[model samples]
Target: MADVNCHKVLMKALDYDERGDKEQAIHYYTMAVELILSIEDKEKREKMNKFARQALDRAEELKGIKKNESPKESGKKSIQTQSASSPTTNAPNKTVPTVPTHSPKLEVTSKEGYTMEEKKVLEKTSTINAKVYVPFMEIDAKERFNFPIPFSDKDGILELSPKQKKEFVQWMRISELCQQPEIIIGTNPDYHAIKQTVVSDCSFVSSLTVAALHEKKFNRRILTSIIYPRNSKDEPVYNQSGKYLIKLYVNGIARKIVIDDYLPVGRHNQLLCSYSNNKNEFWVSVLEKAYMKLMNGYDFPGSNSNIDAYALTGWIPERISIKKNDPDFNGNQVFDRLKEGFHQGRCLITVATGELSDAECDRTGLVSTHAFAVINMAEVDGVKLLMLKNPWSHLRWKGNYSEQDSRWTPELQRILNYDPKMAQSIDNGIFWIDYYSLLNFFDVFYLNWDPELFKYTYCTHKMWQSGIGPVKDAYTIGDNPQFSLAVPQGRGSVYVLLTRHITSIEDFRENKEYITLLVYQHKNGKRIYYPHDPAPYIDGIRINSPHYLCKIRLDPNAARKYTLVVSQYEKTTTIFYTLRAYCREPFELKSLDTYLTTNLQVTGEWNSSNSTAGGCQNHKTYRNNPLYKVTLANDGNLAVELRAPKVFQVGLELTVKELDDSSLTAPFISKTTDNFRSGFCVLDLENLSAGKYLIRPSTFLPNQEAPFFLKLKSSAKLQIEKEQ
Candidate 1:
C-alpha cells in the first residue's frame, strides 16, 4: 500500500513538472520522498527512495531556475548554456560587459571627484541594490469542507471565553442569508456602509473603512487587489467554487490566505462578524473573514488600524502618541504632516482613544478604546478640522463642529463645503471635529504611508533567542543584533522599519516584548564596545507594537558608515523580526558579522583554588586572573572579548610581555577596555606586528565563581592556549 501511494504521488509530481507548475511539483515530490523513506523494509525503502529522491531533486532544480529567471524571460525558454549559437547580424560586434562572479565590482563615480581607490572604498561601504529577503514561502491556506460551515481545522474558530461563548452561535454562508448575493454591491465601495458587529475587531474594520474611502476617492483598487478570482474587468467577483485567496503582507512576506464563503452567524441571523450595510454585498464580510482566519478567528483581541492597513497593503506603519505630559508632542506639526501626506494620497491615517472613564465616554459621545478612521483634513477660517468615521457607522463625536453644533452657519458651511442639513438627516458615524478637540480626546495617531514613495528598498529577516543575550540590556549591547549601513555622500534620508513576527493570538493580548532600534556613528563597521562609549546618532523610544520606524537624515559631508542596533527589554522568548530599509538614494545595508577569518574560543571558570577571578585592576589578585598566550603568524587586526554571566562584570586586557613576567608596570603596547561591563567587554588591537602577546580575562570581584568564554578573532592566522 505504501509503495502504491508513493507511486501515485510521484506520478502527480511528474504531471505538475510537465505542466511547469514548479510549486505543486515540489509539493508532491516532497510527499513521495517522505512516503518512500517511511517504509519499514530496508530493501523496499532503498529501491523506492532512489527514484523518489531523483524526482524531488529535479523539482527543486526547476524551482531554482524559476527563481533566477527575470520577468522579461517569463514566456521564453530558459537557456541551459551561454555557448549556444547566436543569430547572424550585419552590425559590428558590440562589447559585452563582463559580469563578476563574486561580489560585483561597482563602477559608480562620485560627483565629489573621489579617486579610483576612494570610489572603490565608497562602493564597498555603500550597500547599493541590497538583496531583499523573504524568510519563507507563502503559507498554504489549508481549507477544509468537512462541515457545511467549511472551517479550516488548522485555523479553527475563535476560542471565546466562557462568558462570550454563550452568546456565540454557528456559521452560515452568504447565499443562505441573501437571495441575490454579490461580492460588491456597486461600482465603488461605500465607506459609509461598513459596520462592525459582535466581533472585537473594530480596528480591522476601521482599517477597511478608510481603505474603502481611499479606493472611492482615488478610483483605484487597494482592497480589491488582494482578493483573487476576479472578472474580466479585474474586479473581485463571487466564486461559485466556495473558495477565495487573499494576499496579506504578514511576517516578512505577502502570504496567500485561502478561505471559504462561510461566515459566523448568531441567533435571528444577526451577522456575528463585520459586514457591509448593503444586504446583498458580501465583499466586506468575506474580506473580514479571510483576515480573521489569518488571526485565528473572530475572537480577535484587538489591534491598531495602522497594523491592519500594513497587512492589507504593504505600507509603512508609524504611530505617534499624544500625551498631555509629552514635551515633544507637537499637535500642530503632526496635523500639518498628516494633512499634506493624506491629501497627496501617500498616507492612511487612523486615531484611537485611550481608556476613558464611563462619564467621559457618555458626555463626549465617543467609545472608549476604539479606533476611528480619519477621512478628511481641512483648514477653514484658521480652524483646523478633521473628518472621522466610526466603524460602527452610528455613534459620532458631539463636539464643536459636529452636525448640531451652534458654530455651524451658511457661510461657514460653504467655506468648509459641508451641508449641515444633509449631514443631520442620517447618523452615518461621519463627523467633523476641531484639531483642539481631537488632541484633547485622542491618544494615538496611526499613519501608514505608501512604500512606493521611495525608490530603493531592502529587507533582512533574523531570529534572536532569549538565552543568547541578556534579559535586560541596560549596560551592554554586545549581544544585540547589529547591522552596518553605508550611506552615500549625498543629501537624502533613510527609513528603517522593524517588524516583529507574531505567531499566535496571545501575542496580541499581553505583548510582553518591547523592542526599539538604535543608530551609532562607528567607523569601519566596528562592534560597539559600550552602550554610551559613542553617543547614539538616533536613540529610539522602545514600544511594544509590532512595527517600529526609525528615520535618519543623511549629511552630505559626514562619515558614510553607521551601525544599527536592535534593543529589547526583558526578553522572555525567541523573536523573529524583519528589518526593512527604504531610501531614495542607493545605499548599502548588511548584517555586521565582525568575526575575523581566524577565530578561536575557549571556556573556563573562576574558582577559589585558581584565584582566577581577580577583580579589575584595583584588586590585589589582578595578576592571578586567567592568562592566555596569543601567537600571531602575520600582522592583523585582533579582537579579544571576555564574556561571563550577567551577574558579574567582565573585562579583557592585552599586553606585549612574557607570560612569566612578574613586573607590575604596564607594557608600552598594553590595550584594555576603559570600564568593566556586566556580561561582556572587548578590546580591539589594530596593525599588530607578528608576535606573541599575553591576554588577561578578569571579573569585577576576586574569587567570584562563574564560567566565562574567551573569544579571539583576527584577520590573520593566530593561535591561543592557556598560559600556566
Candidate 2:
C-alpha cells in the first residue's frame, strides 16, 4: 500500500509539472518524496532522492521568470542558462541548431546511510522551447589526428619548413602513384614487352638510396649480412647462426648467395635483407625443393627431367619453428628477426581484389586449386621459406599447399624420396608450404601499415585472365587475398588497402556471439545462417567497431532509430592489433575554429592539466601493446576536432585504457572514423600504468572547443535505474 501511494504521488507531481502549476507540482513532489522515504529499502530511498533533486533543479531554473512572461523570452533565458553553466562549452556563435546542454543534478547519499532532509523547491517556467545554433564545419572536422613525424639533431629538434613538408608529402603521393615493378615474367611473347619495360624503366633509385646511405654510414658496399645469437657468456654462435640459412632463387633456379658476419640474427633464426632479384621466381624455387628435392646439387636439366620450365613440386616452408630443445633455437625473440627482415626491404605488396569473373578470369581465385605463382626468395635461418600474402587483408589461399591451409597432406610424405602425395597440389597451381624448410631458410619480407590513422581509397583494374574462355587479354585478380607487386603506372599498379583492424572475422563462425539488438525482422532471415554467410548478430558488431568496417549493405528498411542490446558471451574476450596506412578523404577547407564550435564538442574534463594519469587506458599485454573494446550505449555521440596551425604535421598519440584492469595500458591504435556514431577510433595505450581503464574521452584534442552530445542515457545508468 505504501509503495502504491508513493507511485501515485509521483504521478501527480509529473502531471502538475506538465500542466505548468509550479506550486502544485512541488506539493506533489514533496508528498512523493515522503512516501518513498517511508520505504525501508535503502535503494528505494535513493531513487526518491534522485527524483526530488530533478524536480528541485527544474524549479530553481524557473525561479527568476515572471509568472506571465512571454514563452519566447523565458525560452531564451533557459537556453542561456543551460549553455553558460553546462559542463561542455556552450558556443553561442555557431549557425547550426545544437542540442542544449543541461547540468545533471546528482543526488549523493552517505555510503553507510542517510536520513531524509527536506528543502524548499525552487520555481521555473514549463513550456519554453529553447534552441541554439551551431556551425556545421565545427562538427565535421577530424576529431583525432596524428602528429607529423619529427626529425631531431643532437642539438635539438629540426623543424621542417611548411613548403618542405608539403613537398615531401607530394613526393610520397607521386611515388605511390607511380607503378611498381612487375611481379611475373611470363614466357609468352606479349608479356615480353612488360618484362623488358620493367627491366628498362626500373632505375635502382631505392636500391641506390639504400646503398648510398649504407656507404655514407659504413666504409664498404655490402649485399647481405649474417645474423646469429650469442650464448649466455655473450659469445657469438657463428656455426649455430649458420644452422639457419636463407637460400636464394631466381627464375626458378637456386642461386649462390653470401651472408655477412655482422648481420643481426634473431633468436628464431630470422634473417633480414634489403633487396632481392626475383620475388616470384624465389617463391617457385622454394616450393619445388620442399615438394621435390633432388639434393642441393641436383641440376635443373636432369636426365629424367621432362619439363622445360622450373616449377615447385612439393613442400615449402611458411612459418618459423623454434624449439628450446633444438641445438640453436633462440626462443620467443627468434621471431623478431623475420619481422625486421620485412622492414629492411620496405616490402609493400599489393594484391588483385576478388576473383576475376568469367568476363575477367577463370575459376574464383580460391587458392592452390587453380592459381599458380612464383616469388623472389631470400634465405633466412637454415630453412627454405616462401613468403605469400592474403590479398584480401585476412583471406587465406585455400589451395592445399598454402600456409596453414586445411591439413590435406604431410611433409614427410614428400622427402627427396618418392611419395604419391608429393606434388599433389602443384598441378592445381597453389604454392605449398613445409615447416622444415622454414628453419633452414632465413627471414621473409613484406610491407606494413601504421594502425593509427583513417584510410580510404577506390581503384579499378584491367587485368589478365585464364582458363576456358575467349583469349582474354588480361585477368583481373579481383579481390584475391594473395599479395601483389606494385606494378609501375603504365604496367599498372594494384590498388589495395593496407590496414589492421579492418580485417575482421569474415567468418562469423569463428567468433563468439554478443548482445545484438534486432531492429527489423527480415523475411528471408534464414539466409544469414547459410554456409556462405556466417556472420552472427551483425548490428552490435557494426555499432561497436565502425572504424574497422567495410561496406555495410543493409535492407531498405534499416531502422533510423532502434536499440541494439549487446553483452559479451561468457568469459570470452577479444584483443586487437593493428597495421595501417593513411586513407585520404574528400577535403573541405574550413577554419579550425568554426569546425570545433559547430561540428564537434568536448566530452569529460579538459582543462589542460596534463593529467595523463587520469586518462583512459586500453587492454595491452605489455607496455607496447594496445587493445581496444568498444560498446554501444544509449549515449554514444562523438565529434572529432583537428586543431593545429594550417599546414602542420604532428605525431598524435591516441590511447585506450581498458576499464576492467588495474594497469592502464593498451596495445595499439586499431581504427579511425569520420562519423562519431557509426565509427570508432582504434586505441593506443603504450604509456599507461597497469590497471583496467576507460577512454578518458577528454584527452582527444585537448583545449580544442569542438562540441558533441549523447542522444540517449548511458547504459550503466539505465541498468541501475531499471534495477532500482
Candidate 3:
C-alpha cells in the first residue's frame, strides 16, 4: 500500500510538472522520491529507481537551479533559456540617467525566447521600506523650495530659463485646460498604472511597482500620499491651487516637495515624466516630477529601488539572497517567510535577473536586467503560482505561465483573480510563473518591509568621519562609528539598519565604501564578538553594503548593553549614514559619540623598511622589529591591535621592557607566544599599573614587508610612538 501511494503521488507530480505548476509538483515529487528510495527491498527499489532519479533532478528545478530532464518528460522540455550576458553600463560618467529613446516595438514572435511550449510563449504577461509618519516634520516651504514656477498657457506650462531646459522642459497645471482638472489619488491603485519609461530608474520603478502592489494593505494610503490639503469629498480637489506638495523621505530625512500644478510638457504637449496609462490620470506624472525635483532634477544616476520605495512609502527595504549552489537553500522556508511578510503587510517583494543590456535582454527573451514586483502568490489545485509584473509593461518572461500557457483554466484563473478579457492581451506585461520557474530564473529578491512591523524610529544625517572611526577609533578594525543599546533581557525583539547616504559626487554613484555593521556585548570587562548572527533576521545586506542591518535577541539576566560598530573592509573612506532601530518598545539607543575613550585613543602606521625590521616567526628576526612605546600616567587597561589588508601577512608581538631600557635588544620582561601573529592582531591586557611597556609589530612570515596600522588605547593618560 505504501509503495502504491508513492507511485500514485509521483504520477500526480509528473502530471503537474507537464502542465507547469512546478512548485507543487516538485513538493509531491520530492515526497515520492524520498519514499521510493527508502524501500528496503532491492527489487522494489530497482523498479522505482529510474523514475526516482528523474524526480530527484526535477526536484531541483523547483528551486530555480539546473533543470535537465523531468520524469517521463517528452520531446524537448520547452523551457525558454535566459538571455546571454551583456556589458553593464553606469550612467554617463556616473551621475546621470543616460537613457536613449526606447526603440520601436518589434513583432514579438513565439520563437524568440519562448523555447518552451508554443502555447506558453503566446502568453505574454506581465507583471522598501521605511517608517513613515512620525511626528510630522514641517519644513519652511519658501526656504526649501526656492525654485518657483508660474502657472501658464500656449507655450506649455511653467516658464523655465533655457539654462534649466535640459533638466525640465515646461510645466502645465492639471487645470490648465480642463476647468476642474484634479489629480486623482485612486481609491485603488493598480500595477497597470505603472509602466517604466526610457529612464534607467528601474530601481525606482520596481520599488514603486511593489508598493502599488500593496497599496490596499495600508488602506490604499500610499497611492494618494501626495495631496492638496484643501480638497473635496475626501478626494484630492483642485481649485487652481497653484502649487502642490508631496512628502518624500530622502536618505532618512523627510523633505516636502512643493510643485506648481504645471506639468512638464515636452515637444508637442507630450507629458515628459512617468504618466499613468490612463491619459486622464495625472498622479504618477506629478509624483514622478516631485521625485525628480526632490532628487535635484531628473538627473537620476540610477539608485536602489528599495530606497525609492522608502521615499515613496516610508518602508524599510531589505534584500534577500538565494545562491543556487548554496547547500542550505530551502524553497519552502523562503516561500513561507515571504508569504508571512506579505500577509502581515510587512514586505513588498521584488526580484531581478542577472544584469543584462537591452540587446542581451532581447536576444535572451529576458527583460533587460530589470526588476519585477511580486504582486500575488496563490495555490490552486495544489499548484503554487507567483504573479509578477514588468515595470516597462512589455517584454515579459517567456517561460512557463506566460500569456499563451494552456493552463489558464477558468477554475485556476478564478483562483488567481484573473481577468479573462485582460488575459487575452499578450502585451499587458503581467504574467504568472510557478515558484520553481521564478527561483530558477531570478537570483535577487528585494523585500521592502513596512515600518509598522518594527515600530521603527530613525536618526538621519549621522556623519561618520573617516578619521574619526575605523582607522582612528582604535587599532581594532571593529572600533568605528558605534553605538550602545540595551534590551530588557526579554523584550520582544529589536532590529537595527544602517544605510550609507548615496553620494551625489559625479564619480561616486554606487557605494564608494565597503562597510559592515557588527554588534557585540561588553560583559564582565571582556568583549564577545558575533561575526554573523542576527543577520538572518534583520534586513541583512542589500544589493550592496550601502544598507546593512541585523536583529537582536536578549537572554534572561543577559539584558546587558550591546555595542554596534560600523566598520569597512577597506577602512578608509568616510560616509554619512542613517540608523533606524525597530523594536516593540522604544530602543535604549545611545551613540558612542566621542567619549573618554576618544581621548585615550592613539593610532600609528609603520612600513617594513626591510624584512628584518618586523621579525618573523620562521626567520626569528626578533631584534629586527618595529617597536612602539607606551607611557601610562596611572593604572589603565591597555589594548593594542594591528591591521593590514588581505595583501599582506603581518603580526604584532608583545614584550614588556622597561621604558628606560634604551638598548635595542634589552631582555624582554614578558614576550608573546602564538596569540599575536595575525593580519588583525590584538593584545588586550588587564590590570596594568601606571608604567611603561614596549610593543613590537612583526611579520609572521620571513622577509615580509607591508604597511600596517596599530591602535593603542589606555585608561590612564598615555603617550605612544614608534620606538627609535
Candidate 4:
C-alpha cells in the first residue's frame, strides 16, 4: 500500500511538472521523495529511490534558477528535461519495467517571468499610471492647458527656480522642443553629452553621468531601465501620447512615477531644466523631470550622488569622507577599493568638492561644492589615474594630468590609450587626475554598489513611533527597533541599510532627524540591553541622510547570530523606515518580535513613601522593591523587562515561588539581570514549571526616584498583578 501511494504521488507531481505548475510540482515531488525514503526494506527503497532523487533534483534546479536570475530578468523561461517514468514495485522473480533514457523537454513558463519571490517585491511597489492623473487625450484636446502645472495646492512648480518660473514661456511637448526628438538619441547613453543647466542639482546630474557611463562601458541599462514606454527590445522610447511611467526606488520601495511629456521652456526657446548636449535626446530631460517631480520640483536642493544613484538604480549607497578630520581616511586604500569595485562592475563612483574659495577653485580648475563623475580608473606603470567628468560640460581639472599638464608623456598616453590633443580640442569636461590629486581635491567619495554582488537580499518596512522609547538612545537600546541576522558557518560580507522614508521636502532641507545602525554579536538571538556592553561589531556614525549603511564581515569562528539595532540621536517625529540586508552567503533575517502570546504592562514609580524605591541586592532596601505576582498555567518561557527614565539605572529579578507563598525572602529558581543598565534591563526564564512566581523591578542606587515601566511576556496564559 505504501509503495502504491508513493507511485501515485510521483505521477501526480510529474503531471504538474508537465503542465508548468512548478509550485504544485515542487510540493508533490517533495512529498513523494519523503515517502519513498521512509521504506523499511533496503532493496525495495533502492529500486524507487532513483526516481525520487530525479524528481527532487529537478525541483531544486528550478528553485536555483529563480535564485540566480536578477529581478528584472526573472521573467525568462526555465526549461528542463525529465524521463517519463514512474517507480514500480517488483514481485518475487518478476521483471521490473525499464525506465526510458530520454523524454521530451518540459518548458515551465512563469507568469510574466516573475517567481513567487519577485511577485512579493511587485506587491510592495506602488504603480502610478499617468493617464489616471491627467488623461493624455485631455492634454492633446487642449482641455488641460498644462500637465503637472504649477498650482498653490499641488507639488508642481515648487522646484522651479525664480528665474525659471518668471522666464517660463510655456510647456512644450518633446516634438516641439526639438526637430527630431528621441527619448534616447544614440544607441547607448553618452555620459559626456549630459550637461547641467540652470538647476542647482549638480549631484543628480553627476549621478546620471556616471550611470550613463556604466551603461556605455558595460552595455547595461541602469538609467533607461527605469523609464517606461519602451520598445520590444526593452529600450526606452519617446511616448507620443504625452504619458510615461518611470520606476524609482524611493523611501523604501520601488514606486512608479507617472509624468507627462511636456518640457519646461524658457522665453529664448531654451529648455529651462537640465538637458543633453544632443539637441534631440530627451531622455536626460525626461528622467530628470521624473526625479524632480519626486523632489517636488526643479529647485532641487543639493544632495550627494550616492543618494541619487540609489534612487535611480536601487543600489547600496555608501559615503566615504575624505576630509582630513577623519583620522582613518586612507587615500590609497580608497583608491584601490574604487579601482577594483569600478572595474569589476560592482560599483558606481562619484566625487564631490568641498566649499572652495574662488582662488582655490581657479588654482585647481575645480568647481566649488560641485559633484563630478568618476567614469574610469586605471593603474598604468604604477601610476594611479582616474577619469572624471564635470557636469557643467566645461572646466577641466588643471591638476597634474590635465590636458595642458606636462605629465602627459607619449609613453603614458600610449599606455592609457589616449589622445590628449583630441581631448584638448573638445572641452567636454573630461579630464584625468592622479590618485593623489583626487585625494587632495575631493572632499567626499559617494559609492553606489551593485546589490547583485550578494547572493541574498532582504528588506522590511517599519515605523518608529515617537515617544515610545527614550528620545536620546545614548545608554540603552532595548526599546529601539531591532533585528536578528543568523549567518551560517562561513566567511562572507553582510550589509544592513536603514532608509528613512521621505514624507516631505523638509526631509532634505530641514535635516531634523539623525539615524544610524549598530550591530553586535549576540547569542541565542537575545535582545541587546545596553549600547556598549557587548561592544558593537560595527558602530555607525549618525547622519541626517536618508540612508545609513552598516557593514560587517563574518568568519567561521565567529558567532552565528547577530543583533542589529536602529539607533537615533534624538527622535523628534514619527518616522517611517525600511531596513534591508544584503549578504554574500545564505542568511536569515527577521525582526526580533519580543512580544509573547500573553503579555502585560504596568507603570510604577520609585519613591520614598511607596516602598518601591528599593535599590539593588547590595542595599538592605532591595526587599522593598516593586514586586509583582505571576501565575502560569503551563510550562513555558517568561520574559520580564524594566524600563525607567534615563536618570535611573534599572534591573529586573524574577523568582519562582510556591502557590501560597507571599514572603519575598525565599524563592525556588531565581533569575536576575546580569547588570544594571541605565533606563533598561531584561530577565528571561525558559522552561519554567507551571506555578506562581514573583518579579522584582528595582533601581541601582538607593533613593533614586523615577517612574518606570515593567512588562511581562510568557508563552503560556498567565496573570500578573502588582503585589500589595
Best model number under TM-score: 4
Q: Please rank every candidate by TM-score, starting with the best.
A: 4, 1, 3, 2
TM-score for each candidate, following the candidate numbering: 0.73, 0.18, 0.63, 0.75
- Residues 1-724, candidate 4: write the lDDT tens digits: 5656776666556445534567877898788888888888898787676556555656665565443455456553443332212212211121111000001112211113344533443343232211112212212222222346321222333347776888888888887776667888777888878998888888999999988888888887877877777777767787666666676777666565667777789888999888888888888898898888877677777788878988888889999989654678777788899999999888999999988999989899999989999988998888899999898888989879899888889999998888888898988888999987877778889999887677677777677787555556645566688888888877767878899866566568778889999888854556675676656878889999999988878887864788888888776677777788877677777776544568777656666566667778878999988888898887677778776533345678888677432433333568878766555677777777777888888877666665556767788889888888
Cα-lDDT of candidate 4: 0.73
lDDT of each: 0.72, 0.24, 0.56, 0.73
lDDT of 1 at 544: 88
**Top-down lDDT ranking:** 4, 1, 3, 2
TM-score of 2: 0.18
For candidate 3, the clash count comes to 36
Candidate 4, residue 41: how far the Cα is off, in Å: 80
lDDT of 3 by residue, 249-310 (tens): 65544555556666666655666566677666666666776665545455556666666777
- The true-versus-predicted C-alpha distance at residue 138 of model 2, in Å, is 44
lDDT of 1: 0.72
Model 4 worst lDDT window (10 residues): 95-104
> What digit string (tens of lDDT, one per residue) describes model 1 on residues 103-172?
1122222223334533343233222112121222323323322355533434444445343356557766
Q: Can you tell me which runs of candidate 1 are displaced by over 4 Å?
A: 1-170, 556-559, 594-626, 631-637, 643-651, 655-670, 675-680, 685-692, 698-709, 713-718
Alpha carbon lDDT at 328, candidate 3: 73
